[model samples]
Target: MSALWRRSDLVRATGGSAHGAWQDVSGVVIDSRAAGPGDLFVALHGPNHDAHAFVGQALAAGAAAALVDRADDHPSLAGLPVDAALLRVADTLKGLERIGVAARARSRARIAAVTGSVGKTSTKEALRHVLAARAATHASAASHNNHWGVPLSLARLPAAARYGVFELGMNHAGEIAALVATVRPHVALITTIAPAHLAFLGSIEAIADAKAEIFDGLEPGGVAVLPADSPQFERLRARAAAAGATIVTFGRSATADCRLLHAVSDLSGSDLSVRLHGRMIDLRIGTPGEHGIANALAVLATVEALGADPVQAGRSLAEVAPAAGRGARVPIRLAGGEALLIDDSYNANPVSMAAGLSVLGRASGRKIAVLGDMLELGPEADRMHAGLLEPIDRQDVDLVFTVGRHMQALHDALDAGRRGGHTASSDKMVPLLREMLRPGDTILVKGSLGSRMKVVVEALTDGEAAGVRPQAN
Candidate 1:
């Protein structure tokens, strides 16, 4: 951005010409709402909308430059500054890819990438907490771990960052490996690959194979942090070994480099006693899930691998908190009294659902589970949902509610005597939920993002916290 970006650079990156005047861009953007001065807005086409339609709005919103698929037909062609750049490409995603790779090349930080069926976002948050207490650390914002997200996060990595964390995610095979190939990580953490994304990967073993691909991007002598209790530990261990990287284990196991000696998960927060090497330290996760405790151990190990103080790193985890719609607790007012709400409505698979349910089970008072369908299960969707009946029954949940097309299967699978009635929409669920509510009831809201279960959580709770859209400020 110091000098005018050469037309040749954009041309070479996307094989497109600077048919319009070239300008030096100071920043890159996707959303027209957040566009700023001297920004280059890339108009990405999506299922429901075309970003090309908003080029004028972006330009009006102080965007100095823009990129689109069709250069000649763009409406803002006449308003350009003589030096303004018009970047045209075959695909806007591909053009963003070029920008991202170029930005990564400018950075000198020690990049660490994490992936697993669960806990990727939480572990990444923990990484930022521990690493930032000592150095200038930049990490993926939320769960920015997909195709476009990976490149976009990599592009946003500041060149002056001392440490970096990238959370890579995939629902299908070859996706993680493709991403890993781009942001080469100094330490790759596989929290644990459980039965997730089964529709695309076929089985848990296949998911393990895909999760092991994190090692594909490791630099020589890089570390692979594995959970000792994970059923797939040996598989990942062999894979990391074959990739010529060392392994740092984390779990309750004695052999682990970073292990949890005691974890007390409660409504306030989790009090964790962790063991690193031969030393033991006390730490607390500012969230209320056992899964959060496990994730903190991974962050603790990552800090040690990065040569930071383990005790200080562990203690710093208190600064980390859950994102909205991911185990974020809210208290709701019922007609009779109040109930605790655990809104984990962002995304769900078997592992995260079970973890959330377990955390809710441990809370005080009567338990109410309002669950929805978990998508992308392929063939095992029904059995998987049905498999929760025993756990719910054993956990002594006092009431049950459900929504979505597939959740009805789980609703019917429950015992007739224990059934509290079911509704396929959270709006329609008001009556039964009202009847079931009590002073000390604890309600857990969970489902895949597509199920819109967060709406159900919103209905129960007062809007004191506003909404879940995150901001950079």
Candidate 2:
């Protein structure tokens, strides 16, 4: 939404050419679906499909220009009117990255970068909410936390914004550094070092090390926020200190300058109690997991550490809601009463699975966990899935539905009373789960994106047979 780009500058930067009145260009885009009028649409070439094919659609959407890798002057583009500023790029994705770096370099805002196994979106959203109330803030949209996502978010930054927030993510080494360098934040926050992305990261220590790379772009005196309750708390503090960052901490620790006092959570998530620099603050969060409460505390501390008011930050965080697949709650009306659904199917790993189960346990209805494969765990996959059974009974979750190959381990480990059924695919699992639904039953659906567990949530929420979408939240 920033008017900071110029076509002539892009031509010089990418060694490309522009046609017909591109000098006053302002906006950049990769997705034609989100393009607005006067936007520069860059048709990036992806592995499965070339975006060059979408140039016509971008133009149809009132796009001012299109930069495409149409080397042969694809026939589809020839039909475009002469007024359209159609240009060429050797690679549009790479060109977007170059443009992002230029946008970041030009921004005058105080920037904060967030990354971790979980809570990056919640934390980033919290910061954006807290900061935007006081200043013109720019934040990453959705889970834009990858190589392309980082630049895309940065490119959306306005030149005159007073603050910016980017959620950086990686499943392997060296990815964060590239994005972080482009962001160059005044503050950085690593939510926690959990066992995620192990298929590439190898070990928890390696994960922590990879997470610490968020500081690679910190300006001198930039702050880094870490959770004091995390297992790698000291290691993270040391890593940031080693990287020449000033560390700020939050959690239940007495020494932590920012801390949590209590949380009132049920099937419908939680209301949080926060303590910052000696002032106690009350807040409401849209998630029930203890992890969510802790993450909210972390966000409050980080915002204050970056010079925002802790009180206002805590107040603003109450407005932050969970995304549907992440932690949205839906209630199902049953024959006698109702049922609750915790939809956490957006993503999964060992850490988040346990967190989701914990939230399931706190619900008042008959607790059931609809779990799917947590991919990319490397060797620890089965043990982690089976390990969750320990807390399932302890937390009083009555039934557990395991799906996919990785989840077969959890399926095999379940006892007769708690074991629901193992379905190989989400499509098959949905109808059966639908049949089992009764009033006052609390269902939790969670899995990696590959597992498509959110489909179950969609069916449950939108299924006309089951009553209706839950109002539990």
Candidate 3:
């Protein structure tokens, strides 16, 4: 592999001493399992385990070099008989930050940073797919958008990249500010604000402020893409204006630059039309949800902000499928026929829960919801969980199954005819849910990451024995 970093660059970027022969690597990895012959392994210390313990494993897996902070009593390489390099620094994470900063500085790529209570990963994936169609684009993989995730993505950025996309996430205040500063995005997008991390941040207003922190890292005269329909729109707009960012809005509102004209949906996807700047562009997305339309608008606005063809970006939407756990759909074979399993068990909040309910409302057949608790809701957890009662009834869902303590509120509030079952734990609902599902039933499983609701999604989609009982309308 050609040098991803020069000797001088590594020294200047990390301010660390190089003790062995060094070579440029093609890839960067933190896990020993992922390290290969031409990879740079960064040893990061965490709560569960220390990467220092895996340095030998990384080297054995054919890593070219390992970056470490602990050198004294570090395993000696004298008898290993392998040609490996060891770069020592005072602090491993800070050293990584330096490398990320260096990576951004050396590259001329136009950067876009995204943050939101929901849809951060989905929007990031959409941007990656849309942008890659027009340039040498790089983006955070999966949901890698936290403290280490942001820097690790930046550090992995290739110098030849033409565009870089990053997702920033936080459960507390001041987190997005620090991450956006590192990204220094030319275009920053806030999908929307909601009461996701209420346990840590306190109020929805505080969450809005935390999400607004993404503007602090915007490049001068850069673009701020926002959701025009969001209740926190004015707040985000004010913050963006204060940061000297040009504002562009996208939503179903009249003021939005990228305005959604209409959306027609089916099980496969949605055919949506959005007015970009002044022209109306229609696109079909392979995901099923109104949130998909909203996220696509943000992508369109962002693509235009970066001087890319919004038309091409819109075209790429045809290929944009939902990411696993976020909204990936699976088919389960049954004794009579088959059931459609919608896997949205990744994460959830009140707003996302309503959105998922709306998706269920539009299903072709019987609608069922297997909901788990929304965690980190703090004191209003019960009230927030109970708030779903209205949306559930409005959706006309045939049956509802619930898990977790907080969900008990909604289960109790639901009409007895609509109540499928309620359980203290998700595991106990597996057999009950398995027995309840019928052919043509479209089931949506969703909850916060802490809820572990994906287990039910797994049980259904893994083709378990379909000793099923039919349900009456």
Q: Each prediction's Cα lDDT score?
A: 0.79, 0.81, 0.88
What TM-score does structure 2 among the candidates reach?
A: 0.93
In angstroms, the error of model 1 at 205 is 0.4
Estimate, for each residue in 1-473, the C-alpha lDDT of model 2 and write its tens digit.
34556677677656666766655556778888977787888887677877777888987887888887636567666776676677677777877787788788777888999998987887788788889998899999999989888887887788888889999999989999888999998889888777788989899989988889888789999999888888888878888998899888888888787887877886556887777878888887765688788788887877777777777876776677777788878776555567888888988887888888888888786788999999889988889889878778778888899899988998899888778889999989976776677777888899999999977887777755455333231
lDDT per residue (tens digit) for residues 1-473 in model 1 = 44223346546666665644445666667888878777778888777878877777887787767787755655644455555456778789988887777666767888889999888988898888788889999898878899888887876676678898999999888899999988888899998877878888898889999999999889888999998988888888999999999999999888888888887777757999888887888988887666787888888888888777888887788877777798888777654456688888887887788888888888787788888888888888988888888778766776778887778888889887557677777667755665556666788888888888877777667643223222221
What is residue 245's positional error in candidate 1, in angstroms? 1.1
- Candidate 2 displacement at residue 457 in angstroms: 0.9
Global CA lDDT computed for model 2: 0.81
Q: Where's the lowest-lDDT run of ten residues in candidate 1?
A: 464-473
Q: List the residue pairs that clash in candidate 1.
A: none
User: Candidates' TM-scores?
Assistant: 0.90, 0.93, 0.96
Top-scoring candidate (lDDT):
3
Ranking by TM-score: 3, 2, 1
Candidate 2, position 426, lDDT: 96
lDDT by residue for model 3 over 1-473, one digit each (tens)? 66677666777899888766766677778888999987889999888978887888888787878888845555643344344578778888999899999999888999999999889999999999999989899999778898899889999899999999999999999999999999999999999888898999999989999999998998888999999999999988999999999999999999899999999987678999889999889999887777888899999999999889999999998999987788888888777888888888999999999888888888878899999999999999999999998888888898999999999999999989899999988788899987788889999899988899978877777767366766655
- Indicate the residue-level lDDT of 280 in model 2: 85
